[model samples]
Target chain A: MDRFMSLDRRALLAGLAATGVAAGAAALAPRALARTEPGTVLARAIPSSGELVPAVGLGTWITFNVGEDAEARDACVEVVQAFFEGGGRMIDSSPMYGSSQAVIGHALGRLGAAAPFSADKVWISSGSRGPAQIEESRRLWGVSRFDLLQVHNLLSWEEHLETLFAMKAEGRLRYVGITTSEGRRHAEFERIMRAQPLDFVQVTYNPVDREVEERILPLARERGMGVIVNRPFQQGALLRRIGRRPLPPWAAEIGCQSWAQLSLKFILGHETVTCAIPATTSVAHVRENLAAARGALPDAVMRRRIADLFGTL
Target chain B: MSEWWTYALSDFLLFSPRTYYRLFALHNAALWPAHLLALALGLAGVWMLVRPASWHGRALAAGLAAHWLWVAWTFLLVRYATINWGAGYIAAGFVAEAVLLLVLGALGNRIPPATGPGWTGQGGTDMGWPRALGIGLVLFALLLQPLAGPLAGRALAEAELFGMAPDPTVTATLGVLVAAKRIRWEMLAIPLLWCAISGATLWAMEAPDAVLMPAVGVLSLSAALARSFGGRRGTAAG
Candidate 1:
């Protein structure tokens, strides 16, 4: 019994020693590990005007769904703080994501002047409620002038677009756009891109999900509308698939350290994608994701390699 | 000096290679002492629970319950801060808490049913070293299998099995099985059967990708049911 107790004590001591070593290493590697500033990467000239923004942005789809509580509220504050601190600009939120818009509002209030870029959506299913819905979205985001006002999921597009057009004409919104994901409304996305004079269009375009590559991407490029890529991680499915696979050596050449960076870099590598917004709740994940915006992107060959890697799964 | 407590703490800390290496460098030299203290306390608590004294049993049960509550609270804080306020997150929390409660209940049952005693006239022998070792080994196997075997390749298997799929019927059937308690052991059978049937159907139908979601659904449900019912009953019965 005494021998067993001594062994247990030794084991505990060893475990603690190990934990201390890890924390010290993390503290030392900040410069090597810190995410790159957004401006370092190639910024697309927003074709409407010459406004340049980073090709990679952050999304708050799942991350910003912080319910009414102090800890959740604090987490949202940290997410926003990490995002802006890492030189992130665009933040996309929508009414469909429950309290996402409200959480952004709370974060923005805490962020004050540091809030970089804001783009939100209006999701009204019926054509008749366009005016009231836009007003509500304006009230929700607490911004009289929005950077981009998109018709969420192509809902009530005909009615909402009219108001959005008027808002853009009056300089209430800098851009007018529409978004659809999950390949559910590809036809609608294509039709909107081809026919309408949209300033932007949001769609899902991950390596695992390349359905948009065929039509919508080409149409967006042709129409000169900035494209936003959503579901870049396929909502955590991609990360789970990769598991503990170590990052390939080639990943460092393009500034990709984490799988999150590799995945986001793939989305940003596409020329047509103006910005890709991958969301996360943790500040650590947010910081890791923001690293994708720095350094060189994968060329055509690397993109194919990425696709091949995913294809194996 | 308890081997299992030492193993659990060491294993938990070792799981993260990056974290493990970082902690190795900290030379602060206090971590070892703290871990030793924690392990000693844990072993003492476990010993007290197995003692033939009524007061010790009650005290150990209270300690276990308090420990469970603390862990649950911490998990709740993380989940509530991370996930959206919806039925899914709530349901996930409920499932986690239920599993923890069931496991603790099993452990509680292992403590011999109380009778008039002062470490004498006990109805049965204590779980003793052998049974404790067996329980520890069973747990270690359960924890390690998901990382080592076919389960480790679940993600790829799931994707291949459910190619561009949305079979609501399969999803609904699995959901029903998950909620069913009477056929707890049968829940294990359903998944193995589903995987076999799905594999056969895929081969016979010449639709390799068609059975993906159903196969995945079955596999996941089967694994959960197996864990909930498998060695648990044996431990409780013992």
Candidate 2:
């Protein structure tokens, strides 16, 4: 009994020492648990709830479409790693994008505990059963409950939103939302927002495409729903429009190094925006994009400068 | 000419008129240097291959291969960029051009000599009207396939090219026929086989609305022709 007690005591002491060392290391290097490096700017509360999220997020529409191959897998891993390293948290993907959700799932699996996940959309417009579509989306993402489950492009929003709402009630989803880009179904989107109690609304709002600013953003704010900006670069069209024009002198003040940053900053500056998801295939581009979330945002004057800069185009 | 040159330069330098201006202004200036370095390396490779007793044929083949690879990379980049932005037609054009260049380069080396078709000299004149027309038609069909749909007005426009929408089967079939006539029968089989494999793979992958039957038929015909031709040539030699 004495020998057994001694051995147990020794084992307990060793376990405690090891745990102490691990805790010390974790305290010293917080990045060990971090999905992404915290940017210079702090996260904002999602007005309705005190949920803090990094202002910059990654979109996997184009970049994350790794077509079920090893090379694509590696590229996605690099992109996800860069996003996580650069303080990006929210990763938006969809079924509309080819194998994007699968790639994101693969990256997350590779990332293990370090993966920073957000939400994705279910784009089942073929009149399939809504519950089946949701189940399939859950399976594709490999998550029992999604951070947010959105109806892509407001397609069968009524049916999907009902399912999402029920899931939310059952604590399967933290938030329920609707998404519509390209300003295609604004009237329907507005009607849904007015009628439903949604936590988020995804829309396209960039400097070049200011159509969303007129109604969608204000409506989102009024409804107390977090607005996720999509196509903040107008799918590279805004960058093309601002072609070859040197960044105005004042752009440096807002930490706008590339037009990508400038464009993202413009979207981030909006008080209504919860996060802007810009798609990029390059790791360098991901780093550049994450930088937009850092430092002081452009005030009203700088916003004018941005507007004027692109106005010349 | 000046306008055309300016547009071409802008397209090449800027990647596109839209992207050129943004990167130009944002001080994201690494692309120019990278492009210059790539161009220098490409030129140096070409020069080295062209040097005396440098295995000109192998060098040419290597250069063509390298060019096609580069084009494919750029094609993917452009397609990825443009597709997300709702500029599908522009993306299709870029990809089609890449495919056209690859096909032309592959076939260019295999054309029989112009000296009465049997002399077996180096080859035909570098550029010929028939070959140019065939290439143009193929490129046009490739580019236009993305614009049409199965539900579109034209029957030929409903064919699949490179697994994009609006199946370009009829036009692609016609193009293959033209290619077979213009190029050697033996050489034509390779492209047919490639198309068949690619189409079959796409079909098997459950890609929507892709027709692989024509491509399979073409490959079978090519294989049959190859076998029969080989038998005849062997008997004659004996």
Candidate 3:
């Protein structure tokens, strides 16, 4: 808590200014305090290290695959800027997302600021090639070391995990884990999670995709693993589906202005979920996603209500 | 158990339609005025299709070969490769096609003899259904294909032209191959493969025109195969 509370307030203030967070707002405190403070970005601890990371991180899937387009690259830089301004720290990406890792590196280089939690994955079919790919990923991000590294989709998990575990032991990597998305290979994923000493595990879990809630989340909790939730909006498909319907009146109590916030709140409401990474291209959307980590989170009863409502929709 | 089968086409698509279209818009902007020249060259190819001169076949193949090489370097390698990992392989295909065209049509003069009357009805040949289909496809690739993007609500700037983009280039090449005196089955290979790839890409992006390229590919391949076998049977009977 002492380390988490020692966030650079001056930097946070500058970021808020850059993101146009009105200084005069009642909840805009000068220092990091309680999570309920409207301007306060919520931070959760990784079970292994207890290093606090912002509850909502940015995802770079289809959103950041802009290639060498200068205009799109600038827009991505701006999105990252806004994400930081909105009190975001973790920015998650994978090599499978074309050009996304390079784009993230470009954005970071342009920003010339240190990313708080730089999370990445090694996603190759060949175990022998994992080190080269990881080196390439690091080169693309321009980071000396990554905060977290996961085996993507459980591809060559045994070999990759051995390398990652060795790297973690050498203090080259902060955390090592495995990931799967869209509810794929749960049995295999669970097997790895149960056997390996993992620091984090990323899985697809949202109101609409709750297969993880059945076993994976519980297992992560039991094994003291940090949980990262992906596909919170089903890659924007969920919001589009439920965007037509009006938000429930009860949603205002939890400070959710949109369905996106409500969805993030439900996912984060899970005790095991350390962070929810939602990919977005728009600055306003990134800010909005980070804001879900602020103010009030949905309670268990509200989570149930949200799930039930989405089930019918 | 291998997990490859668990993946869907959508899983392989790494970028969105907006990003994909914007690539072309930027490509067109970066290489301005080249599109006009390419379009003019495409127009020349169309004219060759209608005129049916003996030299027109060689000229058309050489022109298409140049366009293929240009698109491979400018669009595929320089532009599309940044966003798509598989684009390098696709560009290699274009290069192979260009090389084939240079060897078979331009330098070697290996285009098969006209099986029927020329489009202008001058050559002593029989105008057949396959030739008509070929002419129709050429016109489509030249005139109508560019409109698909704009019609599907994409901006005019993002329109993919024949010489500048791969889709129309391959489509036009297939049409010319099919419309030739006889179908050169060997030359049809890459273009037909490109059609399937293009169609699959669009389908993965959930684009409305997903079926367009594949449908064109299936139609042209079926026509060329049927014509080739029928021609052999006719010669055998005679």
Best by lDDT: 3
Model 2 error, position B170 (Å): 6.3
Q: Which stretches of candidate 2 lie over 4 Å from their true place?
A: A1-39, A126-128, B1-172, B175-238
Query: Between the candidate structures 1 and 3, which one is better when assessed by DockQ?
Result: 3
Considering only N, C-alpha and C atoms within 3 Å, which residue pairs clash in candidate 3? Answer: B116-B125, B116-B126, B117-B125, B117-B126
Instruction: List where candidate 3 sits over 4 angstroms from the true fold.
Output: A1-35, B112-124, B231-238
True contacts kept of 2: 0.00
Docking class of 1: incorrect
Higher-ranked by lDDT: 1 or 3: 3
| Maximum-DockQ candidate | 3
Candidate 1 regions exceeding 4 Å error are A1-41, B1-238
* Position A251, candidate 1: lDDT: 82
Task: Point to the candidate with the largest TM-score.
Answer: 3
- Give the worst 10-residue stretch by lDDT in candidate 3 chain A: A19-28
Q: Write the per-residue lDDT of candidate 2 for residues A1-313, one digit (tens) a residue.
A: 0000111223323423464443333234332121222344334335444355666788876556544345557877888888877656788987667567777878888887654546888777644476676677678767666788788888777777878788889887778889977677788889999999998899988777778888888888788888888988866768877788788777888778988898888877776777889988789999998777776677667776786677677
Query: What DockQ does every candidate get?
Result: 0.04, 0.03, 0.64
Candidate 2 structure quality by residue, lDDT tens digits, B86-176: 2244334434543443455333433211121232333322223333333333444445443433333323322333322212322332333
Model 1: fraction of the reference interface contacts it also forms = 0.09
- What would the per-residue lDDT of candidate 1 be over residues B1-238, giving only the tens digit for each residue? 1233323222111011211111222211313343234334444543443343434433433433343343234333332223323334533443443343244333443232222213354343332223333223222222322222134233322221110111221232232223222123432343334445434433433343435545545554554445356634422222
Query: Candidate 2, A175: how far from true, in Å?
Result: 0.9
